[model samples]
Target: MIYTEENIEAFNEQARLKFPENKKFFDRLKNKKIKKLDEAFHPVHEEVFDEVDCLKCGNCCKTTSPIFTDIDIDRIAKHLRIRPAQLVKEHLHLDSDHDYVLNVTPCTFLGSDNYCSIYDVRPKACREYPHTDRKNIAGILPLTLENTKVCPAVFEIVEQLKKAGLGNKGGIVE
Candidate 1:
C-alpha cells in the first residue's frame, strides 16, 4: 500500500479488528519456540519495509512514547543545548514502569511533517520501534503483536508471516 494517512488509518482499524486472531497466532508462535525466527523475520522485515515508508505514516510517533533511557536523555539534551534535568522537567514524566516517557503524545519533538525533530539524538526505543529486525525474535512476539496496531509495516509483516505459515512444524505449511 501507499501508506498515506488515510490508508494507514484504515489499516490500523483493521489491525484492531484482527487483534484477537493475531494475538492467538503470536501466542502459538511463542510457545512453539520457532527456530531460526530471525532468519524467518529478517527477510520479510526487509521486504515489507522496502514497500512501507515510515515517514508517510508516523502513527508510532503520533501515538506512542518511547522509553527514554538516561543515555537518551543526556544525548537529546546535549543536542538541544539544554540540561538533562531541564529536559526531564519540561518534557518527560515517569510512567508506571518508572521509565521516562514523553509528557505528551505526538511527541514534543515531532514535526507536523511526521519527521522527528530529534532524530539524530532520539531515544534507543524510538530507533528500535517495532523491534522486528532484532535477534531473538521469538522473545519479542508479544511486543511485535502489540506493534501491529501502531505500525502498518508491522501489520503487513505479521500477515505475511502468517501466510508463510510461521509457526507450522512442517516447513512452510502449504
Candidate 2:
C-alpha cells in the first residue's frame, strides 16, 4: 500500500499508541538499517515519495534535533529578529555532537499549521528533512536510516522490501 502523507501521519500516531508493543520491531528496523545502510538505499528510495507537511507528522521536526551550523544559527536568528543567544535560549541546546539543536519536542519552532516558525532561515537540517533524496542519493542512506523511524515513507518502503523478498536478495530492479 502506498503511504500518503496523511495516512503516514495516522500510522505514526498509531505506532506511538502501540509503541510499547512495537518497540522491539522499531528497534529491529533501526538496527537493521545501521547494519545494512547500503542495502537500504534502493529499497527505501525506490518508493514514490511525498512532500512533507510538518503539521501532519511533526515527529522529525519536533522529536529529534538537527545539526545546526553557525550560519544556520545566524540565519534563523535573523529571521526571528533577536540575538543568536536569545534564539538559542528560546529554542535550542548544545548536543553531544557539539551542534546547536532544537531543545524541545513537537518543536518549539513548529507552528500549529505545520509551518516552521523560521522557515526561510530555518536550520539546514530542516531544509533537508528526508536526506534520501534524488540528488546525491547514493551518499545519503546512512543519514536516511537515522531518520527512518520518524519518517513513515522510509519506514514503509523498507517494510515493503523485506516482505517482498527484496531485502535479502538485494536484486537489481530493471
Candidate 3:
C-alpha cells in the first residue's frame, strides 16, 4: 500500500485489527531461541523498505518523538550553531523516562514535505525509527509489534513474516 495519509490511516486500522493475532505470533517468536532471528528479519526488512518510502509518510515523526541522546543534542546543536542547552530549551523537554524528547508533535524539525530539517544531524532514534533491521530481532519483537501501528512498512514486514511461517508453532521454516 502507498504511504500517503489516507493509506496510512487505512493501514493503521488494519494493523489495529490484526494486532491481537500479531501479538500472539510475536509471543511465540520471543519464547523461541531462534539463533537466526536476525537473518530472518533483515532480509524481510530490506524487502519491505524497498517497497515503502518513509519520505511519503511521516506518521512516526508526526505522532511520536525520538529520545534525544546527549550525542544527538551535541551534534544537532553544532549543526545549528547553537548551544546544546539552547537547543534543548527551545525544542525539548525531559520525559518520564528522563530522556530528552521533542516538546511538540509533527516534530519541530519536520517539514511540510515530510523531510527533516536536521536530516543530517537528526537524533539516533530518528535514524532507526522502526528498529526492524537492527540485530537481536527476538529481543525487540515487542517494539516491532508496537511499530506496526505507526509504520506501514513494519506492518507489512510482520505480515510477510507471518506468511513465511516465522512465528508458527512449528517454528521458523527457514
- Measured over all alpha carbons after superposition, the RMSD of each candidate to the real structure, in angstroms, is 1.6, 5.2, 1.4
Model 2 stretches with alpha carbons more than 4 Å out: 1-47, 51-54, 134-140, 160-167
Off by over 4 Å in 3: 171-174
Off by over 4 Å in 1: 171-174
Separately for all candidates shown, the number of backbone clashes (residues 3 or more apart, or on different chains) is 0, 1, 0
Question: What is the Cα-based lDDT of residue 154 in candidate 3?
Answer: 86
Write the residue-wise lDDT of candidate 1 on 1-174 in tens digits: 657766777887799999998998888787877778899889999999888878888989988999999999999999999999999999999999999999999889999899999998899999987899999987888889999899888888889998888886665521
Pairs of colliding residues, candidate 1:
none
Best-fitting candidate, measured by TM-score?
1
Put down candidate 3 lDDT per residue, 39-148, tens digits, no spaces: 88889999988888788888999999999999999999999999999999999999998999999998999999999999999999988879999988777888899988
Which 10-residue window of candidate 1 scores lowest in summed lDDT?
A: 165-174
Error of 2 at 30 (Å): 13
Clash count (model 2, backbone only): 1
